[model samples]
Target: MTQKKDTILSREIGKLGGFGARLVAGLLPKNIFELTIETHSPPETALEKAFTILSTEGKVIEDRRIDPNKPAVCAIVGSGLGNLNPALVEVYVVSTKENITKLVIIGTAKEGLIKQYAGEKAARRIADLLTQVLP
Candidate 1:
Protein backbone atom coordinates (compact mmCIF):
# COMPACT_ATOMS: atom_id res chain seq x y z
CA MET A 1 0.00 0.00 0.00
CA THR A 2 2.86 2.39 0.84
CA GLN A 3 4.54 1.75 -2.48
CA LYS A 4 1.32 2.49 -4.38
CA LYS A 5 0.83 5.72 -2.42
CA ASP A 6 4.37 6.85 -3.18
CA THR A 7 3.93 6.26 -6.88
CA ILE A 8 0.67 8.20 -6.89
CA LEU A 9 2.23 11.10 -5.03
CA SER A 10 5.16 11.22 -7.45
CA ARG A 11 2.81 11.27 -10.42
CA GLU A 12 0.82 14.13 -8.94
CA ILE A 13 3.99 16.07 -8.28
CA GLY A 14 5.09 15.54 -11.86
CA LYS A 15 1.76 16.81 -13.12
CA LEU A 16 1.98 19.90 -10.94
CA GLY A 17 5.49 20.64 -12.18
CA GLY A 18 4.39 20.39 -15.77
CA PHE A 19 1.48 22.73 -15.12
CA GLY A 20 3.74 25.28 -13.49
CA ALA A 21 6.14 25.16 -16.38
CA ARG A 22 3.35 25.70 -18.86
CA LEU A 23 1.96 28.60 -16.84
CA VAL A 24 5.31 30.33 -16.79
CA ALA A 25 5.74 29.80 -20.51
CA GLY A 26 2.30 31.27 -21.19
CA LEU A 27 3.11 34.36 -19.14
CA LEU A 28 6.43 35.02 -20.86
CA PRO A 29 6.63 37.48 -23.75
CA LYS A 30 6.90 36.13 -27.29
CA ASN A 31 10.36 36.55 -28.78
CA ILE A 32 9.44 37.90 -32.20
CA PHE A 33 10.92 40.85 -34.11
CA GLU A 34 10.66 42.39 -37.56
CA LEU A 35 12.72 44.73 -39.74
CA THR A 36 11.79 46.23 -43.10
CA ILE A 37 13.86 47.96 -45.75
CA GLU A 38 13.43 49.20 -49.27
CA THR A 39 15.88 48.66 -52.12
CA HIS A 40 16.15 49.81 -55.73
CA SER A 41 16.20 46.24 -57.02
CA PRO A 42 13.06 44.66 -58.45
CA PRO A 43 11.01 42.16 -56.41
CA GLU A 44 12.45 39.02 -57.98
CA THR A 45 15.98 40.34 -57.84
CA ALA A 46 15.55 41.46 -54.27
CA LEU A 47 14.22 38.06 -53.24
CA GLU A 48 17.12 36.29 -54.91
CA LYS A 49 19.55 38.56 -53.14
CA ALA A 50 17.82 37.97 -49.82
CA PHE A 51 18.05 34.19 -50.29
CA THR A 52 21.69 34.38 -51.14
CA ILE A 53 22.46 36.59 -48.15
CA LEU A 54 20.39 34.63 -45.64
CA SER A 55 21.66 31.28 -46.84
CA THR A 56 25.08 32.34 -45.71
CA GLU A 57 23.73 33.07 -42.23
CA GLY A 58 21.70 29.86 -41.92
CA LYS A 59 19.79 27.18 -43.80
CA VAL A 60 16.97 28.39 -45.99
CA ILE A 61 14.19 26.01 -44.95
CA GLU A 62 11.63 27.26 -47.45
CA ASP A 63 11.34 29.61 -50.43
CA ARG A 64 8.08 30.01 -52.25
CA ARG A 65 5.59 32.46 -53.68
CA ILE A 66 2.44 32.62 -51.62
CA ASP A 67 0.45 33.79 -54.60
CA PRO A 68 1.03 34.53 -58.24
CA ASN A 69 0.17 38.20 -57.76
CA LYS A 70 1.39 38.62 -54.19
CA PRO A 71 4.78 38.90 -52.58
CA ALA A 72 7.22 36.02 -52.20
CA VAL A 73 8.06 34.60 -48.79
CA CYS A 74 11.17 32.77 -47.61
CA ALA A 75 11.76 30.93 -44.35
CA ILE A 76 15.14 30.41 -42.78
CA VAL A 77 16.41 28.76 -39.63
CA GLY A 78 19.33 30.90 -38.51
CA SER A 79 22.28 29.31 -36.79
CA GLY A 80 23.08 30.85 -33.44
CA LEU A 81 25.65 30.14 -30.76
CA GLY A 82 24.58 26.49 -30.84
CA ASN A 83 21.72 24.17 -31.70
CA LEU A 84 19.66 25.34 -28.73
CA ASN A 85 19.64 28.96 -29.95
CA PRO A 86 18.29 28.65 -33.48
CA ALA A 87 16.24 31.58 -34.79
CA LEU A 88 13.36 31.21 -37.23
CA VAL A 89 13.30 33.90 -39.89
CA GLU A 90 10.65 34.80 -42.45
CA VAL A 91 11.44 37.16 -45.31
CA TYR A 92 8.84 38.75 -47.54
CA VAL A 93 9.75 40.52 -50.75
CA VAL A 94 7.15 42.97 -52.03
CA SER A 95 7.12 45.35 -54.93
CA THR A 96 5.94 48.69 -53.57
CA LYS A 97 6.60 50.63 -56.80
CA GLU A 98 8.46 50.47 -60.06
CA ASN A 99 12.07 49.47 -59.45
CA ILE A 100 11.49 49.57 -55.69
CA THR A 101 11.35 46.40 -53.61
CA LYS A 102 10.54 46.18 -49.92
CA LEU A 103 11.97 43.37 -47.86
CA VAL A 104 10.42 42.49 -44.52
CA ILE A 105 12.33 40.16 -42.23
CA ILE A 106 10.62 38.65 -39.21
CA GLY A 107 12.64 36.62 -36.75
CA THR A 108 11.51 34.58 -33.76
CA ALA A 109 13.30 32.43 -31.21
CA LYS A 110 12.28 30.15 -28.39
CA GLU A 111 11.37 32.27 -25.38
CA GLY A 112 13.64 31.79 -22.43
CA LEU A 113 14.35 33.64 -19.21
CA ILE A 114 17.87 34.57 -20.24
CA LYS A 115 17.77 35.12 -24.00
CA GLN A 116 14.71 37.13 -24.91
CA TYR A 117 16.51 39.41 -27.38
CA ALA A 118 17.82 36.64 -29.60
CA GLY A 119 15.12 37.05 -32.20
CA GLU A 120 15.56 40.81 -32.50
CA LYS A 121 19.29 40.46 -32.78
CA ALA A 122 18.99 37.90 -35.54
CA ALA A 123 16.48 40.00 -37.46
CA ARG A 124 18.67 43.09 -37.23
CA ARG A 125 21.69 41.16 -38.42
CA ILE A 126 19.80 39.77 -41.40
CA ALA A 127 18.41 43.21 -42.27
CA ASP A 128 21.85 44.74 -42.13
CA LEU A 129 23.19 42.08 -44.41
CA LEU A 130 20.40 42.62 -46.90
CA THR A 131 20.76 46.39 -46.80
CA GLN A 132 24.45 46.21 -47.56
CA VAL A 133 24.07 43.76 -50.44
CA LEU A 134 20.75 44.66 -52.02
CA PRO A 135 20.78 47.41 -54.60
Candidate 2:
Protein backbone atom coordinates (compact mmCIF):
# COMPACT_ATOMS: atom_id res chain seq x y z
CA MET A 1 0.00 0.00 0.00
CA THR A 2 1.06 3.55 -0.66
CA GLN A 3 0.53 6.61 1.47
CA LYS A 4 -2.69 8.34 0.64
CA LYS A 5 -2.64 11.93 -0.43
CA ASP A 6 -3.51 14.44 2.22
CA THR A 7 -6.99 15.92 2.15
CA ILE A 8 -7.35 19.52 1.10
CA LEU A 9 -8.12 20.62 4.64
CA SER A 10 -5.22 18.63 5.98
CA ARG A 11 -2.82 20.06 3.44
CA GLU A 12 -3.91 23.58 4.20
CA ILE A 13 -3.67 23.00 7.90
CA GLY A 14 -0.18 21.63 7.50
CA LYS A 15 0.87 24.69 5.59
CA LEU A 16 -0.72 27.03 8.08
CA GLY A 17 0.68 25.25 11.09
CA GLY A 18 4.13 24.88 9.60
CA PHE A 19 4.34 28.50 8.65
CA GLY A 20 2.60 29.75 11.75
CA ALA A 21 4.75 27.70 14.09
CA ARG A 22 7.91 29.07 12.52
CA LEU A 23 6.68 32.61 12.13
CA VAL A 24 5.09 33.11 15.52
CA ALA A 25 6.81 30.36 17.46
CA GLY A 26 4.39 29.81 20.36
CA LEU A 27 1.41 31.71 19.08
CA LEU A 28 -0.15 28.75 17.34
CA PRO A 29 0.10 25.88 19.75
CA LYS A 30 0.94 22.43 18.50
CA ASN A 31 -2.12 20.49 17.37
CA ILE A 32 -0.38 17.15 16.99
CA PHE A 33 0.57 14.65 19.67
CA GLU A 34 2.47 11.39 19.33
CA LEU A 35 2.71 8.28 21.48
CA THR A 36 5.12 5.44 20.81
CA ILE A 37 5.08 1.90 22.15
CA GLU A 38 7.05 -1.23 21.42
CA THR A 39 5.33 -4.52 20.83
CA HIS A 40 6.64 -8.06 20.79
CA SER A 41 4.56 -8.87 17.74
CA PRO A 42 5.85 -8.52 14.19
CA PRO A 43 5.04 -5.46 12.12
CA GLU A 44 2.21 -7.00 10.17
CA THR A 45 0.60 -8.43 13.26
CA ALA A 46 1.03 -5.20 15.13
CA LEU A 47 -0.59 -3.23 12.34
CA GLU A 48 -3.58 -5.53 12.28
CA LYS A 49 -4.01 -5.23 15.99
CA ALA A 50 -3.81 -1.47 15.77
CA PHE A 51 -6.38 -1.38 12.99
CA THR A 52 -8.82 -3.39 15.02
CA ILE A 53 -8.25 -1.19 18.03
CA LEU A 54 -8.79 2.00 16.09
CA SER A 55 -11.82 0.73 14.23
CA THR A 56 -13.73 0.36 17.47
CA GLU A 57 -13.00 3.95 18.39
CA GLY A 58 -14.00 5.49 15.07
CA LYS A 59 -14.03 5.15 11.30
CA VAL A 60 -10.71 4.32 9.71
CA ILE A 61 -10.23 6.78 6.85
CA GLU A 62 -6.99 5.46 5.32
CA ASP A 63 -4.59 2.56 5.67
CA ARG A 64 -1.54 1.64 3.63
CA ARG A 65 2.02 0.48 3.70
CA ILE A 66 4.54 3.28 3.41
CA ASP A 67 6.63 1.34 0.93
CA PRO A 68 6.00 -1.82 -1.03
CA ASN A 69 9.54 -3.06 -0.52
CA LYS A 70 9.42 -2.23 3.18
CA PRO A 71 6.06 -3.58 4.21
CA ALA A 72 7.16 -3.33 7.81
CA VAL A 73 6.39 0.38 7.74
CA CYS A 74 2.74 1.19 7.42
CA ALA A 75 0.17 3.78 8.48
CA ILE A 76 -3.47 3.97 9.41
CA VAL A 77 -5.52 7.12 9.74
CA GLY A 78 -8.83 7.31 11.55
CA SER A 79 -11.41 9.93 12.37
CA GLY A 80 -13.25 10.22 15.66
CA LEU A 81 -16.53 12.04 15.26
CA GLY A 82 -17.75 11.77 18.79
CA ASN A 83 -16.51 15.19 19.64
CA LEU A 84 -17.96 18.40 18.28
CA ASN A 85 -14.54 19.12 16.87
CA PRO A 86 -13.52 15.91 15.17
CA ALA A 87 -9.97 14.62 15.49
CA LEU A 88 -7.74 12.56 13.24
CA VAL A 89 -5.54 9.81 14.54
CA GLU A 90 -2.60 8.43 12.59
CA VAL A 91 -0.86 5.24 13.62
CA TYR A 92 2.51 4.28 12.16
CA VAL A 93 3.98 0.82 12.59
CA VAL A 94 7.64 0.04 12.03
CA SER A 95 9.64 -3.08 12.57
CA THR A 96 12.74 -2.23 14.57
CA LYS A 97 14.04 -5.71 15.38
CA GLU A 98 13.15 -9.32 15.01
CA ASN A 99 9.88 -9.89 16.82
CA ILE A 100 9.86 -6.26 17.90
CA THR A 101 7.71 -3.54 16.41
CA LYS A 102 7.33 0.13 17.21
CA LEU A 103 3.95 1.79 17.01
CA VAL A 104 3.75 5.56 16.78
CA ILE A 105 0.26 6.94 17.29
CA ILE A 106 -0.34 10.59 16.54
CA GLY A 107 -3.50 12.55 17.19
CA THR A 108 -4.26 15.89 15.58
CA ALA A 109 -7.11 18.33 16.01
CA LYS A 110 -7.87 21.88 15.09
CA GLU A 111 -7.77 24.32 17.97
CA GLY A 112 -8.55 27.93 18.67
CA LEU A 113 -5.99 30.39 19.98
CA ILE A 114 -7.86 30.94 23.22
CA LYS A 115 -8.78 27.29 23.80
CA GLN A 116 -5.84 25.10 22.88
CA TYR A 117 -6.67 21.93 24.74
CA ALA A 118 -8.63 20.09 22.07
CA GLY A 119 -5.56 18.62 20.40
CA GLU A 120 -4.08 17.43 23.63
CA LYS A 121 -7.34 15.89 24.72
CA ALA A 122 -7.72 14.01 21.48
CA ALA A 123 -4.15 12.77 21.64
CA ARG A 124 -4.43 11.62 25.23
CA ARG A 125 -7.66 9.76 24.53
CA ILE A 126 -6.17 7.79 21.67
CA ALA A 127 -2.98 7.17 23.59
CA ASP A 128 -4.89 5.75 26.50
CA LEU A 129 -6.99 3.53 24.27
CA LEU A 130 -4.02 2.11 22.39
CA THR A 131 -1.85 1.72 25.45
CA GLN A 132 -4.50 -0.26 27.26
CA VAL A 133 -4.88 -2.70 24.38
CA LEU A 134 -1.72 -2.72 22.23
CA PRO A 135 0.71 -4.12 24.76
Candidate 3:
Protein backbone atom coordinates (compact mmCIF):
# COMPACT_ATOMS: atom_id res chain seq x y z
CA MET A 1 0.00 0.00 0.00
CA THR A 2 1.14 3.53 -0.77
CA GLN A 3 0.63 6.57 1.39
CA LYS A 4 -1.68 9.16 -0.07
CA LYS A 5 -0.90 12.90 -0.17
CA ASP A 6 -2.91 14.68 2.45
CA THR A 7 -5.31 17.16 0.92
CA ILE A 8 -4.06 20.53 2.07
CA LEU A 9 -7.11 22.65 2.74
CA SER A 10 -4.83 25.40 3.94
CA ARG A 11 -1.10 25.31 3.51
CA GLU A 12 1.06 25.88 6.55
CA ILE A 13 0.84 29.51 7.62
CA GLY A 14 4.63 29.83 7.93
CA LYS A 15 4.99 29.27 4.21
CA LEU A 16 4.46 32.90 3.29
CA GLY A 17 7.54 35.12 2.92
CA GLY A 18 8.49 38.65 1.86
CA PHE A 19 7.36 38.06 -1.68
CA GLY A 20 4.12 36.58 -0.35
CA ALA A 21 3.82 39.41 2.11
CA ARG A 22 4.41 41.83 -0.70
CA LEU A 23 1.67 40.09 -2.63
CA VAL A 24 -0.62 40.36 0.37
CA ALA A 25 0.35 43.96 1.10
CA GLY A 26 -0.65 44.65 -2.45
CA LEU A 27 -4.17 43.18 -2.13
CA LEU A 28 -5.37 44.17 1.37
CA PRO A 29 -8.37 46.39 2.09
CA LYS A 30 -8.15 49.78 3.78
CA ASN A 31 -11.62 51.02 4.86
CA ILE A 32 -13.66 47.85 5.01
CA PHE A 33 -14.15 45.01 7.47
CA GLU A 34 -12.92 42.57 4.82
CA LEU A 35 -11.80 42.62 1.23
CA THR A 36 -11.05 39.89 -1.27
CA ILE A 37 -8.16 40.17 -3.71
CA GLU A 38 -8.89 38.12 -6.77
CA THR A 39 -6.42 36.49 -9.15
CA HIS A 40 -6.48 34.13 -12.11
CA SER A 41 -3.61 32.07 -10.75
CA PRO A 42 -4.37 28.50 -9.67
CA PRO A 43 -4.92 27.98 -5.95
CA GLU A 44 -1.91 25.70 -5.52
CA THR A 45 0.50 28.04 -7.27
CA ALA A 46 -0.83 31.12 -5.54
CA LEU A 47 -0.76 29.47 -2.14
CA GLU A 48 2.77 28.20 -2.62
CA LYS A 49 3.92 31.74 -3.34
CA ALA A 50 1.97 33.14 -0.43
CA PHE A 51 3.33 30.60 2.02
CA THR A 52 6.89 31.37 1.00
CA ILE A 53 6.29 35.08 1.46
CA LEU A 54 4.58 34.69 4.86
CA SER A 55 7.30 32.45 6.32
CA THR A 56 9.93 35.15 5.82
CA GLU A 57 8.44 37.81 8.11
CA GLY A 58 6.23 36.19 10.72
CA LYS A 59 5.83 32.80 12.39
CA VAL A 60 2.71 30.69 11.94
CA ILE A 61 0.14 30.85 14.71
CA GLU A 62 -2.61 28.66 13.25
CA ASP A 63 -2.84 26.37 10.29
CA ARG A 64 -6.40 25.20 9.63
CA ARG A 65 -7.30 22.90 6.81
CA ILE A 66 -9.93 24.19 4.39
CA ASP A 67 -12.98 22.33 3.11
CA PRO A 68 -12.81 21.58 -0.55
CA ASN A 69 -16.53 21.97 -0.96
CA LYS A 70 -16.37 25.60 -0.02
CA PRO A 71 -15.24 27.96 -2.71
CA ALA A 72 -13.36 30.01 -0.10
CA VAL A 73 -11.76 29.35 3.26
CA CYS A 74 -9.79 31.34 5.83
CA ALA A 75 -6.08 31.28 6.60
CA ILE A 76 -5.79 32.28 10.24
CA VAL A 77 -2.81 33.34 12.38
CA GLY A 78 -1.11 34.02 9.13
CA SER A 79 2.36 35.32 9.85
CA GLY A 80 2.28 38.38 12.19
CA LEU A 81 -0.75 40.19 10.90
CA GLY A 82 -4.42 41.30 11.56
CA ASN A 83 -3.85 43.84 14.30
CA LEU A 84 -3.82 47.61 14.72
CA ASN A 85 -2.15 50.11 17.06
CA PRO A 86 0.84 47.87 16.75
CA ALA A 87 -0.14 47.58 13.08
CA LEU A 88 -0.47 43.89 12.31
CA VAL A 89 -2.74 42.24 9.76
CA GLU A 90 -4.40 38.86 9.37
CA VAL A 91 -4.13 37.61 5.84
CA TYR A 92 -6.57 35.12 4.29
CA VAL A 93 -6.40 33.47 0.90
CA VAL A 94 -9.71 32.58 -0.77
CA SER A 95 -9.74 30.31 -3.78
CA THR A 96 -12.38 28.98 -6.16
CA LYS A 97 -12.53 25.86 -8.32
CA GLU A 98 -12.64 28.16 -11.34
CA ASN A 99 -9.04 29.11 -10.56
CA ILE A 100 -9.91 32.59 -9.31
CA THR A 101 -7.83 33.35 -6.24
CA LYS A 102 -8.37 36.07 -3.66
CA LEU A 103 -6.51 37.49 -0.71
CA VAL A 104 -8.83 38.27 2.19
CA ILE A 105 -7.05 40.71 4.53
CA ILE A 106 -8.77 41.98 7.64
CA GLY A 107 -7.63 44.59 10.19
CA THR A 108 -8.53 47.82 11.97
CA ALA A 109 -7.32 50.70 14.24
CA LYS A 110 -7.53 48.67 17.45
CA GLU A 111 -4.52 47.32 19.26
CA GLY A 112 -3.51 43.82 20.41
CA LEU A 113 -3.23 40.69 18.27
CA ILE A 114 -6.94 40.06 17.82
CA LYS A 115 -7.56 43.62 16.72
CA GLN A 116 -7.70 44.61 13.06
CA TYR A 117 -5.21 46.65 11.01
CA ALA A 118 -4.87 48.10 7.51
CA GLY A 119 -6.02 51.62 6.73
CA GLU A 120 -6.93 53.16 3.40
CA LYS A 121 -3.31 53.79 2.64
CA ALA A 122 -2.41 50.19 3.39
CA ALA A 123 -5.23 48.87 1.22
CA ARG A 124 -4.17 51.11 -1.64
CA ARG A 125 -0.60 49.99 -1.28
CA ILE A 126 -1.75 46.39 -1.38
CA ALA A 127 -3.88 46.98 -4.47
CA ASP A 128 -1.06 48.74 -6.23
CA LEU A 129 1.34 45.96 -5.42
CA LEU A 130 -1.09 43.26 -6.58
CA THR A 131 -1.16 44.73 -10.06
CA GLN A 132 2.59 44.27 -10.21
CA VAL A 133 2.88 40.85 -8.57
CA LEU A 134 0.07 38.74 -10.05
CA PRO A 135 0.37 37.60 -13.62
How much RMSD separates candidate 3 from the native structure? 12.2
Q: How well is each residue in 2-39 modelled by candidate 3, as lDDT tens digits?
A: 11101111122113333454344334332334556778
**lDDT of every model, 2 decimals:** 0.63, 0.56, 0.39
Off by over 4 Å in 2: 1-30, 65-82, 114-116
Order by TM-score, highest first: 1, 2, 3
For candidate 3, the 10 contiguous residues with the lowest summed lDDT are 1-10
Q: What residue pairs are clashing in model 2? A: none
Ranking by lDDT: 1, 2, 3
Task: Name the lDDT value of residue 100 in candidate 3.
Answer: 76
Best by TM-score: 1
- Quality of model 3 by C-alpha lDDT: 0.39
Error of 2 at 24 (Å): 19
In model 1, residue pairs whose N, Cα or C atoms come closer than 3 Å (at least 3 residues apart or on different chains), thus clashing, are none
Candidate 3 TM-score versus the reference: 0.43
- Candidate 1 lDDT over 71-101, as tens digits, reads 5544444434553345666778755687687
Error of 1 at 92 (Å): 0.4
Pick by TM-score: 1 or 3, better one: 1
lDDT tens string, model 2, 45-133?
A: 66676677667765566666444444422223333343544456666774568767787776665554556554556656666766776
Q: Give Cα distance to truth, residue 127, candidate 3, Å.
A: 6.0
lDDT winner: 1
